[model samples]
Target: MTAQRACGLSDLVQDEARRVEIDGVPMAVVLDSNGEVHAIGDTCTHGDISLSEGFVDGDSLECWAHGSAFSLRTGKPLNLPAYEPVPVYAVTLDGDDVLIDPSVTLDVN
Candidate 1:
């Protein structure tokens, strides 16, 4: 997988997220409380809404529409209304930049 620069490290603050379109895929790049970076599908599995528009609490990413929080590391839904997991992409930190490979996604298996 090729890593593409999504945003500058300074652009993304702690416990915040940014919505980016990489390779025609809508991705929500988030910064967690652990100071690590994560990427998940911007669209919530439960409904047609952008996860980037939601809020980030620690490692839990919540949907703005119906309040569903998903684990940042696993993309596993932590609450009801969403049973299936969303696609999570790989993330990398290089200097003061955050990179993500939209072409790569977590295998449900």
Candidate 2:
């Protein structure tokens, strides 16, 4: 599938996560403090909670229910309770738009 507009750049706040679903695939779109945009799976691997509703610290998104921190860049869980890594999608910036393709994930290894 092609890249679709997830949200506008103005809709995102630094160090915050916004949940966006594309083609039934849920994703967490984050804009870090460094002005970099990242897209990762929204569901917490440790629980059924949404990762977008969690905390964004630096480049990682921490699960509020289990304290499992997932890297926004690699999508790998940095702590216990969640060893499974989430899919990291490539983010595209088109003017004020943030585009992402759910079928296209980055090989962040």
Candidate 3:
């Protein structure tokens, strides 16, 4: 897996979303309510709005532009206005650093 340094762990707190662009691909590194770090496509599938500007609850991410929610781990659409699943990247914690593999695709579907 190709890893990129997104941000430091201190930059992300529990239940928060942080926006970062890597290699021209915009993405969000979210710390869910479960305190897990998830990297997902920052753009909402239904629109051009940034999912990083949305709300984070557990493993679900809510799009602020349309209220559509997405699963952080699976990148699945969980509500109306969004039928396509966003792409999710893999995240690895290396000490205090946040390492993300933006090119990694989910094997499921």
Among the numbered candidates, top TM-score falls to 2
lDDT for each of the candidates? 0.88, 0.96, 0.88
Model 3 C-alpha RMSD to native: 1.2
Error of 3 at 34 (Å): 2.0
Local accuracy of candidate 3 as per-residue lDDT tens digits, 5-90: 99998899788789998888899899777668999999999999999999997888899999999999899999999999999888
TM-score of each: 0.92, 0.98, 0.94
Can you tell me which runs of candidate 1 are displaced by over 4 Å?
none
lDDT of 2: 0.96
lDDT of 3 at 43: 95
Regions of model 3 farther than 4 Å from truth: none
Cα lDDT tens digits, model 2, 3-80, are 999999999999999999999999999999999999999999888889999999999999999999999999999999
Could you tell me which residue pairs clash in candidate 1? none
Candidate scoring better on lDDT of 2 and 3:
2
Candidate 3 C-alpha error for residue 90, in Å:
0.8
- Candidate 3 TM-score over all chains jointly: 0.94
- Candidate 3, position 88, lDDT: 87
